[model samples]
Target: MDGETALDALQNLTSAAGTNYSIDKNSDLGDMYFNMTNYVGDTLKMMCMMRSHHMLTDVVLQAGSEQFHAHKLVLASASPYFKAMFTGGLKECDMSHVKLQGVCPTTLARILQFMYTGIIRVTEVTVCQLLPAATMFQVPDIINACCVFLERQLDPSNVIGIANFAEQHGCKELHEKANQFIEQHFTQICQEEEFFQLSAMQLVALVKKDALNVQDEQDVYQAVLQWVKYDEENRRPKMEHILQAVRCQYLTPAFLSKQMKSCDLLKKLPQCRKYLAQIFKDMTLHKKPCVKERTPNTPRVIYIAGGYLRYSLDILEAFNADDKTWTQLAKLTVPRSGLGGAFLKGMFYAVGGRNNAPGSSYDSDWVDRYHPVLDQWRPCSPMTTPRNRVGVAVMDGYLYAVGGSSGSDYHSSVERYEPDEDRWTLVRPMQYKRLGVGVAVVNRMLYAMGGYDGINRLNSAESYHPENDEWTPISPMHVARSGAGVATLNNCVYVVGGYDGSKQLNSVECYDTEKDTWEFRAPIRISRSALSLTVLDGKLYAMGGYDGTSFLSIVEVYDPTKDVWEEGEPLTSGRSGHASAVSFHQCVIHCDQHEHSLSTESSLGWCSTRPSSTLSALAGSALNGAVPEPRTSGVGAVSNSLSAPGRGLPDGSGPSLPYGP
Candidate 1:
């Protein structure tokens, strides 16, 4: 007998056991147990070995019994009768202690097999029974296996039962899976009376928690309607609750309105009718509001103005920094009595426009430049072609003028304005002439959205690129409109109210540059066209415009974050075709009505009340400089430092508008 022979014998025994056991020869046990003993030592070893073997066998038998007892203890945790027999054994067990349990014995046997061999075989019938036992024993693997088997067998008809079982056991994953399955198959199961028995509050909870899909939502609505038939008085309160929940969750107004009409709930209850109306109004009025606030950190504001009426200027405003307020800074010097303006670099160049003269040509080649910094107006080189009611916007610092009407005739001529040389260059003309169209810049590209294309109001839109001077067609808008105000915010360009050939439009639509798609947004509070559009602090403000009958002073602010519109302070004057601009410091709004004079009130620039000495010290520390000695006269020293550069505006010319309002 040698070490090799002993090792071979152990391997043979392990193979014969039929258990998946393999001893590693590199293990510590292999090094210690491999050697064999001599003949005399072997005799002594045989006797010792026999005793040791007996002790080891006894220990293993005791361990097996203990394991059985432990298993019984775990089972007894779920039931008491099993505990008494396993813990007290036959010696102490009696009929009185053996209280019959309801759980299947076969299920218990399967659980015991899993505990002993770490293997489980689940059948459809026993899966339900074994799941609870596995959960009680804290056997995660067995519980998972049982759940998988149950899930695979579950269908729409068995969803309720599966949901109940999962809920009772507090199995979150299983519950979610069952809930999703039920939602996906709700149409098949919703015909049952049990679903209708659920309270309206419960139904609402299901919808709000996303436990129902579109089909399931329809089923719930149908079921709730059916419930109302049996007991109107009992179900009215529930219906109201469900309607309120749906409204709060921001469901489509059209769908909610349909539901209300289908159920006749609104007619039955006065309060329900009022609530429904309010929800519809609120949904239609939803808008994104301005979130950016003016602070000491804000820099400068840029203003742009343009117009289409005689002696009027239509303004297209924008901000240069992160601030949300529109500060009137830039202006159009030579106001095109009835023309459009576009911005390039820091200058707003007024495009082709017309002056009032009956029977005279409605076209002028005049252009103006208003310096934002100097707050003064000056003349700029005019356009090559004279036209009015044109679409203008800046792309990559080049001003582009789209289609317009020249001398009572519509022209599709396109021109580009260069600020450096103060000259206009002709570009490729548009395929169709579009007058009073909405123009917007998104990602350095100009979009010529819906407007009147001479013959009829057009729903068509097109994109222009300055790099190649090429025009490409885009998907048309939902409504054929003209005079719409277009502005871009958060990467989406919004086309606000305009006229749809026959009537003024209150419709609002958005175009996503990333998706290259169009969608209807919350319409404006009033139907209008020729309105001024600007984005300040991320919120879009739709200012003065004509609604069909009269000019509007209504100013509605759109909040993108909340997707709601709130009434803002109306402009001092109601005039369409105004100019708007936003900057980090303030918001500047301008209109072309001479009757509505411009306000000289300062827009309240960023003002801090902290002591001048403290501010100076802070500034010094930021620059890593030594603390300067304070002057004896506090008043004079404070005034001098506070009046330094970057402190505030130097001229204090109220806010600047690119053109005279």
Candidate 2:
């Protein structure tokens, strides 16, 4: 043979025999490996050719009016549906022809090609048909491919349709992506015809989500009216039930009044009119709405509200840990200092404190609930007695407002707020009257620490069991403290910086709820009283308060593991007697009000201003599993935007007895 021809023959012979072997160099390990580099590719290519030419074909898949010739072995190997049909004693096991009832012929052909070639083209035009067939045939990879294609094609015009499609086919990832898209673009989506086509249940589901992104609650109210007005004769009955989805309590009294007078449908439906009237009455009476419910992927924020600046200020601000910056939100309903604050359910309640707004100089019995998503404030059923420098804690879904001064006398009385009833009932009183008390709940028991009891700053502590409504004394702290910040962590209640009858104290102590014993921990760097304590990311944060000389803007973080204190980002302004609570809120970071792309991967730290047509590049990057690290500034980043800090709620009240003035 010629030299070139002989070499070619030899190489072909070696490749065909599959004798490519590699040996391990380690003498201790006796191992050898042979790899056929293109074996899988070659086999799949040969099978594809055979199926296309109908050579050695074992089965015919009939979908609609077309037939696809494919090998039983290849089809069964690639699809669980075919595997069960051929091997699970089904009649189709012996049959040469199989009929797929609901699958389309075009979709079947593509699926069969994918079974042999491991490739399928999915696009907007083909995905609608392809996904259902792939789902029926139990082809998860192709189904996922179709879903990914649909997700990219989502927008206000088509998201509702896509969400319905995903829901019907039980595609969970696609459904959630579409639902989140709906939430981010509710105002625009409601204007679309597809939103009008939604059934009552679907409409209610969309409107009631706390994550529904709207600049104002009025948008939701208007949308509901539009939906009902679309087909008044048929939909008017569903109005009362659907109106409940709209947070009418948050709607402006003027807006509600305008709707009641202007809308013909609302007037026609007696039940709808009554519901709106009750909501208006409650709004006027200052009875707040129930606490909001937070969804998954919401951002956790630290809210500091109602502190004394020069006088009692109604300032409300949120600290974003990801950016280490603060954004001023809506002000408190009443300007008050020495307030008690806690997050019950998903709402932040600014409990009893003194309203030091110049002429108004009395302690407040008012309980205002802050809506984190709306950045709005509304009053709830007020406490039985007005209080200042009160202690607050949440236990078993009820908000406890503990002892404080009533502008006349120090009180040991405690009241429990029931959100469902929108009323505060007096619970068991404490053994000692405590003003400026520190309260914490652990192991289903509420613990009240040191405070002033009419005369002296007390060091005594007590625990209350809500089951029997009684208080039992616990071990006392080493130092007498009043206005101390209290927080719970690792089964221990921590008490930080407070006044000890003489001077601002920097001492810190932790009481083990299990052991009922007190032990000292690392003290704060700044000696201050009326500072707010909150736990986040397993660390204790002591926020702004006042020292003996001046109001301090210091923030100290305590680490239990190292037992040390470190300086953190300070507050925007110095304030004392402010209330703080840590909560998971859906934080909307505004960036010039631009739109961005939709990303299905919702994470905690990332912030986007608009849900649609914004962050397009970041969305794709996240889909590819290479999510960029979160930042405070970028193309579409979370900027340090500040709103005005002095907005107050309008005055209105239906009755004065329990709802407060």
Tens-digit lDDT track of model 2 for 1-661: 5545544564575468764444445456766555656667767876676566677889998987788888999988988999999999999999999888997788888898898888999865677678888888899989899888878777666678888788878899999998888887676779876788888998898888988766457778899989988888899899999998887776656568888888888878888888888887765543435534223344558889988765678888888776687777767766778789998755889998765543235577878887664456776777888878899998756899999876447899999998868988999999999988999976557899998886688999999876578999999999998888899987699999888766788899999876778899988888888889999878999998878667768999999999999999999998888899987544443223441212232333223443333222212211122322322111111112212222211100000111111
* Local lDDT at 148 for model 1: 81
| lDDT (Cα atoms) of all candidates against the true structure | 0.55, 0.76
Q: Cα deviation in Å at residue 443, candidate 2?
A: 1.3
Give TM per candidate.
0.42, 0.54
lDDT of 1 by residue, 1-661 (tens): 5545554565565456554333346575555323332333433333333333332211111221132112333344434544555566664343323222444556655665554445688875566677776666556777789778766654544555666677777677887777766564454545544455545655666544443433113344555566566567887766666655442323435556775676566678777777767755554443221122112222334354544332244334443433343334334433333356544443445566543322222356666654333344566666776665567776544677777665435667788776667778998777678767778876556788876665687888888755566788988888887777888888688998877766777888999876778998888888887776777657888877776655666778899888777886565455565555443321233434212112111223112232233212211211111222322211100111121211111111001111110
After superposition, the stretches of candidate 2 with alpha carbons farther than 4 Å from their true spots are 1-125, 128-148, 152-297, 585-661
Number of the predicted model whose lDDT against the real structure is largest: 2
Best by TM-score: 2
